[model samples]
Each structure stands twice: as structure tokens, then as C-alpha cells.
Target: MSERETWATRAGFILAAVGSAVGLGNIWQFPFKTAEFGGATFLVVYLVAVFGIGLPAMLAEFVVGRKSNLNTIGAFERIGYRNWRFVGVLGLLTGFWILSYYSVVGGWVLRYVGGSLTGAYFGDAQGYFGAISAGPEAIALHAVFMALVVGIVAFGIQDGIEKATKLMVPSILAILVALAVWAFTLPGATPGYAYFLSPDLSQLRLTVDTTPSFPWLTFGGPLAAIIPFAVSQAFFSLSLGMGAMITYASYIDGDESLFGDSATIVVFNTAIGILAGLVVIPLLFAQGVEPGSGGAGALFISVASAFADIPFGRVVGVVFFLVVLVAALSSAISLLEVVVSYAIDNYPVSRPQVAVGLGSAIFTLGLPSAWDTAWLTWFDTLAYQLLLPASVLGILVFVGWVFGRPGVEELLRGTGFGDGVGSLWLWLVRTVVFLGVVLTLALGLLTLFGGADPAIVPPL
Candidate 1:
């Protein structure tokens, strides 16, 4: 095999990781989910979950990747845990499964970028979104988006993924900072900030009646009702549980501080998510559109409609959607990398060939979702409810139980941290992180099979 590729710089690696985490998950999903689940109430739960559960889980993937310096599957086998290679296999599958629908969403962002410049969706944002969200147009755009991803990955790591993300991540942050400043001056900005940042603890503990029409109705508490979605949102927002991190970390050239880098990536990702909410939520409020009014298309429909009446609306819309497009492409690159890295690591195929071939196949798999919005919704549910949580749980188990001390040592290298910290991290992964994921996965299954409240489960 040819020599493995590595990141051009430490900053390049950090930006690439942040780019992976700071995509549609932050821009498209965060505001809508915050709106749907009582605004700041959801925000609080999401923060707790991100730090408490998401961070440790991310550390586990970092350990595996940098230690073995290989793709997810080969990382396991390289470490002499051949049987546990299934964990990496699951991650590869999760990344592939996710990008199928993720590409569909990326296509949506691309369409919105065009529509913003032409004011195509200004008059009837909802109608326009409904019209273009599925069918031939969506499929065509999805293929376009996948082609962009394939083109980038075909250029190899240093020239393609790293360089692209260096530009994209910084551009995204700069645009969002400007947009958030402008959004603060909107008439309803106060209420929007209050809704997004001010916590209402009662909403966090809210309950629901499963069946109001019959005696079979069962009531569920906040813990059972809300934790799964919040946890899944954390996983989704940080790009955890998919081995995207593992694939990216494999490119690191030296012994960097994994803990420090993990924390930096987490901070950047979470900040982008909050900045997105600041921009979108206030804009929705400014238009007098109630939160959650637009359903699954909340970010697209609600924000686009709000732009119709604002000053310089067309220009603002163009800039905003351009930010979304950049974020989407950055994330799509990471997801495709996971699959492309696996193919080149294990087979005789070249990077360009694997990128194009796998990109085409993934696009074919996503056609169902592109053909119908209902299929998109189904894919979203399956990801949050099963694929993400399951992949995360498996990785934690491997690092904590299967890989054992060697994995902990990998994590602590170059951090100047003692064995005590490693032991604590391992303990958290084994117990808190592990059990928390188990509970999240179990609750997701219950929500799927036991008919949990639709309000608690994210319909998106």
C-alpha cells in the first residue's frame, strides 16, 4: 500500500474536525429543535448532554483513531482487537447511512442559496419549500451535492479535505457573527433571545398523555420523554457516534493533546449552534411566526418567509444560505471521508476511484429520500433513534472494556495529565457514558416500539 496521508498542520486538523461538527446539525437542526422543544428549555438539556455524554464519547473515538493511525475498521484490527472490529464496521455503516439523507438536506441548502439570490421563495416560502423538497428536483440537487463532495475527496487529504475546511470553517464563523449582530437589532430580538437563552426549567420536566381518547393512555415524565432526543441531538451536533472523528483523527501527524483538541472542537461546534439559534430564532420571532410553526422545514420556511419583509432581505438571505451551504459541504466532506478512507485502506482502489464510486452508490441509496419528504423524515428518525446512539455505545464499550489500558494511554499522551485523569476518563466511559448511552438507546427503542409521545420524539 502507498504511504498514508496526514494533515498539513495542527490548525488544519482542528479546523477540519470543527468543520465536521459545525454543519447542518448546527445551522439547520439546532434552531428548529430549540423551537420545537420549548426554546431555551431544550437548549439547557442539550448543553448538559453535549458536555456530559458527548465529550467522553468523542474522546473514545479520538483515542482509537490516533492510536492506530488508520481507518475505523483497520484501527480496531491494528490494535489486535479483531473481534471488536464490528464496532468500527458499525461506525462505517452509520456514516454511510447518515450521509444518504444528509446529502438530501445539503441539496436543500443549495437550492435555498439560489432561491435567496433570486427571491424565488420569498412570496410563498412554505409553498416553494413543499414544492421543491422532494421529487425530481430534490434528487437532481442531491446528486449535485454528492458530486461536490466526491470532487473534494478525490483530491486526497492535504490538498482536498484539509484545505477546503480551513477556508469553509473560518468563513462560516465570520458570516454567522455578522448575521447574529444584525439579527439582534430586529424588533422581536429581545423575546427571541429570552426564548433561546433563558431557561424555563418547567418545560424541561413537562409530561404528556400518550392517548387522550382512551383509558389506555399512559403518562410519561420528562426523563423518559425528553432525554433521548436531547442526547441524540448532542450526538448529531458534535458529529459523534459515526466514526467521522476516527477517520479524521487518523490524519494527525504527531502526538497532539487529544484532550485539548477535543475540548476546542466541542467549543467551536457548540458556539456555532448557539450563533445559529441567535440568528434564526430571532428572525422567526421578528416575523411573528411562532416557534415550531414550520415543522420540519422550520429553518428553511420560517427563516425564508421572515426575509421577505426585512430591509435588504434578498442580500441577507443570500449571505445566510451561503453560510449554510458552506457548513453543509464541510460536513458532507467528513462523512464521505469515512467511507472513502475505509475503501482505500483495505483495497487496491485509488482515492479518486473510491470517492467517485462510493459517492455514486451513496447517492443511489439516498434517492428514496430525495423522491419523497416522508422518506427523509423516516431516515432522520432512524438515525437519531438507533444508528447514532448504537454506534456511540459500541465505541465506548470498546475503549472502556475491550481496548482497556492501552486506549487510556493513547488519550492521555502529550496532555501533561497524570494517570489519575486517564483512570477517571476510563471510569466515566465505562460507567457514566456507557450507561447513559444505554439508557438513551433503550428510551429510543421504547419511543419507537412503545408509542412514546410524539411531542417528545423529534418528528424531524
Candidate 2:
């Protein structure tokens, strides 16, 4: 029998997890990254990444979660050697680091949610974003954001996040799609499409002798960029390489097909992400907004500005920002749920108390991120570099090396994929996924310490 908590219904479970995956990353971050990176070509690379990097890595998490049916740390302990416990602990720390900045960003969204109603950031959007993005004002908003997340976690999994998502995800999707539809009707979209969809040819000039920069910006530059982008995107999109999914899976019941449900979550998440790009890229393209402003607050600022100049823009602004507000909360609830689930599963801490503790901690730590964008970048880098790679590597080792092939194969068999998973996957888990993760970790570490030209380091 599966030990993790299951959703009261299949619909609740899929929607809740999808709610977690389909958030600011897809909506807010996707448009900005595409524009900033190289437009349509980058999107092409990213979509490839979604399939190769995200799909496989996601399956790995599903297998681990459904099999063990325990909270992160506990899941590791239950599966393999005592040392595996450290992996789980590391995952917890990873989540903590991510949540610190994530909560701050969440607050920024909350701030906009409130501001959109008043058009406070509507005029001179760039300057307004600069003024409020990092400071005491940001801190206050972060606290409010953390409080909302804590409130949901306190309410318990199936009861709170599931219910909230049931309300939030649909609204988030509806608004974004509507916005996309609106964006298509406008003009000046050709350049935006060219920049985002058509690949620039010059970036492809680099060959083996010369190093490439922004290859996707050029036509047929590096097919390799697709791998890192996809891997990283998968990590970001699934919210995997972190403990969130493990925590959610810990609460799942065994009778249902974990694979089937997880697939639904991934597809829904991808759709939302694509839809967000639809809203963002076309809008900016149709307007004459400079693509240079694609920063963290770019989406919030740009989208609001776009709406402000349009007919009936105020209502549109409110509707669009509300989409972001809901998306942020959905993901925030997942992050909060990680800790809250642990408290309920492992300790006698009442659900409400669990929420209070985790929420307070997130709010407090989130202050630094809110008040300092530098700190936010640091936390994101650390989470992605140190915590994620290490944790994923640790999991491969635990399942492949520690638990051995038989144990893992049994878990895969637990699903309807049946014996079709077979010896090949077992071999891959042992050799490819496990070894590949270690190498990726090494490269990530190297990138952290090894490469640094004077221009990059001092930014002269």
C-alpha cells in the first residue's frame, strides 16, 4: 500500500499539482526569458528542453515519490541507506533557499495585485518598478505574501491548496488566453514575431574554434543549448530538482496511477506556459515597448503599461495582474505545502501550527530577498546550482546505488506502465541518469567557480 496522502479525488490531485507547476515561471518569466534570450529561436530551444530535460526528470520524481510515499527526508530514509537521509535533508534546505526568494517574488506579485487596481505603477512603469522592487515597501508586501501562503498550508493539503487551486488555476488560464486573443488583434506584431519566432542568423557564426554567444539568437547555432535550457526549464517548470513534488507525492495514495496523473499535471503546466507567452510576446510586439525591459518585474510592469495605454485598459490591467496574482499564490502554496506536509506527516504538530511555523520562517527569511534583489539572485543561483544538482544526484545514488535495481524496478512496476519499464530503465537509472546527474553537478560547480573573465567578474 502507498503511504503518501492521496487527493480526495483524482481531479483535486491533478489540478493542485498543476497549479503548483503553472505559475510565474510560465507566465511571468517565460515571455521575458524568450525576449531577453533571443525570441522565437529561444522558444524553439526551450520547447525541446521541455521534452527531453523536463519529461524524463519529471518521471524520475514521480517514480521516487509514488514509490516511497513519504516526506522528502523520510522518503530517502525509507528507500535506502542511512546516508540517503542527508540527501533528503539537503532537499529540504534547497526548498528553504528557493522559498526565501520565491516568497519575496510572490509578495511582489501581491503588491501588483493591489496596485493594479489603483494604477499606481501604470504611469512611468519602469521607474515605479525600480522604486518599489527592493526596499522596505517590498518587505511589507513579502510578509503579506508569506501570510497568504502560510494560511493555505495551515489549512492542510487536500483541504486548502487543492481547494484554492480549484478556484485559481481556471481563472489564471482564462485571463491569459483572453489576453493572448486580444494581443493578436493589434498591429506592430511582425517584429515581435520575428524576434521571438524567427531565428537571427549572425549568432550562428561561431564554430568549434570560436566560442558561441547566444547561439539561439542566430539561425541553427547550437543544438546543445537546447539541452541546458530544457533541463533547467524542466527543473523550473516541474518545480522538481527541489522537494516540492516529493512532499506532494508523500501525501498521495497508491491505488491510482501516479504516472497518469503526473502527465496531466505536466501537460497542463506546459499549456499554461505557452499561453502566457501568447499573451506577453504579442502584446509587447504589437506595442512599441522596448524588449530590453524583460527583467523580473518586466512582465508586471510591461503588461500593466500595455493595458494602461489601451482602450478600457484599467479593467484589462486588473484582469491580467490578477492572473499573475493567482499563479504566484498557486506556486507559493506548493512551496509552503512542502514544509507543512512534513510537519503533519512526521510530527504531531497540528496542521495550523505547522503552517504558522513554516510561514513565519519563510516570511522572515524572505525579507532579505524582498529588500535586496542581489539576495534574490543569490538564493536562486544557490538553489539551482548547489541544492538542485546535489539533491537530484543524491536521489539517483540512493535509488540506483543504495536501494539497488530490484527495489527501483518494483516501484516502477507499482504503476500501470507495467513491466514495460523493464530492465532498460533499471540500467539507465543505474548508469545514465545517476552518472549523468553527477557529471551535470560537476559542470554546474565548474561554472560556478571555474569561469570568470575580468569583464564578467568586475563588469568594467
Candidate 3:
């Protein structure tokens, strides 16, 4: 049997991890979510969730993967907990589920990148998006995106994943910073900043306005509704609740500051998300756009439309979609890696074979989502609302109870932190992070079942 591969450098691992974390969630979803949940108030709640919930959960996953020094499923098997292996399985499945539709969305970004350069969608953004969103074009683009992802994964870790991220992550950040600076210079950009940075207490209060409809709106105040969204975003944005991080961690070659690396990923990811809002919100407000309806089309329609109206709109559009393309590709690589790692770890097959075979299967599974909007919506809700939270809860149970003292020792292996910090982290994962995810799950269920007001549901 061939030996397992490891990351060529600690920096490679960190860049790869950060690349995974900063994805479409940062570039596409964060700004729209902020606009929907009352701007500044949502930002505050999101920050709290990132530190309070996201950080600990991420570190916990790192502990398991690094300790076991194996793929997600292999990690649990090596730990000698047969039952707990299910968590890894769940994560692996979630990664597959997410990547299926995720590739479809990545395809949208790719299509727009081309459209931007050729001025294809310049005049009618909405019409163009609607036309391409769920059709043969969408499917073809999705295949192209998946092919790119497979090509990367087929190259193996250091040469493929690490090197790609090292180039992609820095470029993503630089583009975002430059766009944000330009956005702020636009006339009437202050309103966007105000809406994004100033808290509204009324928005924070849960108040439902009922209607005799299946998808009702139960506004559970900002604290009840918005916080859950923030928590989920933090999880999704950091690529938690999936085996992506675990699989990436399996490539680590030596002991290092897992805690510090986790923290850095969170910081860089959050900064990019905020900077995205800075660019998007101000640009929209300056152009007298409201990011209307906050659908999947929000970024494509409103932001793209704004670009159409601006000087050098074509140039801006190209840069913007290029950023999204990079972000999507980086994240898609990680999601694909989780599945590739599993196949390689368990089966006697070459990485290239697994990459192509599983990549094709995922693309086939994602066809319904590409062909129909409703299927896409349900798949997204299923993964994010149900599977993701449940997966994280399972991890918490395994780490907090199954691994117990050994888990803490694993976490403290490289970091100089004493047992006290480890104990506190464990407690936080068991109590705060666990409860926060539970709340998110409950809220998601409520929204999914039409118990909550549809009005309060974040834009699709």
C-alpha cells in the first residue's frame, strides 16, 4: 500500500484551511444576509456567534482529525469508537450533499464572469439570471465547474490543494479590499455603511405578523431569528459541520498550534465576509438599489445591475465575478476533497479515479437542483437546517463525552495552554456551542415547516 500524504508546510495547511472557510458564503451570502437581518444588529450577533460558537466547534474538529491522523471516517475508527464513526459518515455525506448544489452555484459565478467580460447580462440582469439559472446552460456550466474541482483534487494534496489555495486566498483578499475601497468612494455610499453598522433595537425584537398562508412569518425578533442565521452562517462560512476541515487536518504532518490556526482561519474568513458587505452594500445603496427580495438572484441582479450603471461597469463586473469565481473554486475543492479522501482512505484506487468517478456521481446527483429551483431550495435547507447542525451536535457529543480527557490532551498537544483552557473549551463546545446549534436547528425546522413567518426567512 502507498503511504498517506501530508501537507508540505504548515503554511500550506493553514492557507488550504482558510481557503476552504472563505467561500461563496463570504462573497455572496454574507452581504445579503446582513441586509435581511437588519444590518448592524445582525453583524453584532454574527461576531458573537463566530467567537462564541464557531471557534470552539472548529477547534474540536481539528482535535479529532489531527489526533487520529486519518480521514474523517478513518479518524473515528482509529479512535476505537465504532458508534462515533457515524458522525464522520454523516459529515462525509453532508460534504457530498453540499458540494452537489454548491457546484451549481459556482457555475453561476462562472457564467457571470464570462457575461461580465462580454457584456452579455449588461442591460437585463434579472432576465438574464432567470434565463440561465435553471436550464441546460446551468447544467453545462455546473459540469465545467465540477471538472475544475476534480482536476485540482486529482493532483493530490500539497501539489494541488495547498498550492491552489496559497495563490487563491491572497488574491481573493486583495480583490475584495480593492473593490471595497472603490465602493466607499462612490457617491451616497454612507447609507450602506449606516445600514450595515448601526443597530436597530426594534429589528432585534421578535414580532410576527401572521397571514393565512402555509409559509407564515413569525418574526422572533432579531435575537430569536437573526442570531440563529448568524450562528448557522458562522458554521457554514467556516466550513464546519462537514468533514472538509477534518479531511484537511488529516494532511497535517506535525504538532502545531491547532487553536491558533483555527483562530486565524476564523479571523481571515470573518474579515473577508465583512469586507464583502462593505463592497456590496455601499455599491447597491449608491446605485439606489435595495438588494431586492434577497433571493439567489440578489447578488446577480442587484449588484450586477449596479455595476451596469457605474463607470467602468464592465471592468468592475469582471473583477467582482472573478473574486466570486476564486472563492467558489477554493471552497469547492475542499468539499470535493472530503469525498476524495474517504474513497482513497477506504478503497484501493488512485486519487484520479476517485476524483473522476465521485465527481461524476455528485454532478449527476446535483442535476435536479440545476434543473429545478425547488429541488435546490430543499437540498440546501436539508443540508444546512437539518444535517449540518445534527452533524455538529454529534461531534460535540463525541468530543465532550466519547473522547473526554483524551480529546483535551489532543487539543493541548501542541499549544502551550494548560488543562484549564482545554477544559473551558470542552465546556464551551458542550454547553454554549451545542446549545447555540440546537437553537439554530430548531429555528431552521420552524422556518422549514412553515411554523415561522415566511417574511422572516432569510432570502433564498
Whole-model lDDT values for every prediction = 0.89, 0.69, 0.87
lDDT of 2: 0.69
lDDT of 1 by residue, 236-276 (tens): 88888888999999888898999999999999999999999
Best by lDDT: 1
**lDDT tens per residue, model 3, 212-257:** 5443444466577686678778878999988988889888888899
Clashing pairs in 3: 204-222, 205-221, 206-220, 206-221, 216-453, 216-454, 217-453, 217-454, 218-453
Quality of model 1 by C-alpha lDDT: 0.89
Which candidate number has the best TM-score? Answer: 1
Tens-digit lDDT track for model 2 on 60-108?
6666666677777777666655567777677777777777788778777
Clashing pairs in 2: 4-250, 4-251, 4-252, 5-251, 5-252, 39-196, 40-196, 40-197, 49-230, 200-218
After TM-score superposition, the amount by which residue 202's alpha carbon in candidate 2 deviates from its true location, in angstroms, is 8.2
lDDT of candidate model 3 versus the reference: 0.87
TM-score for each predicted model, relative to the true structure: 0.96, 0.87, 0.95
Model 2: residues >4 Å from true position, as ranges?
Answer: 1-5, 199-230, 404-415, 422-424, 427-443, 452-460
- Rank order (by lDDT, best first): 1, 3, 2
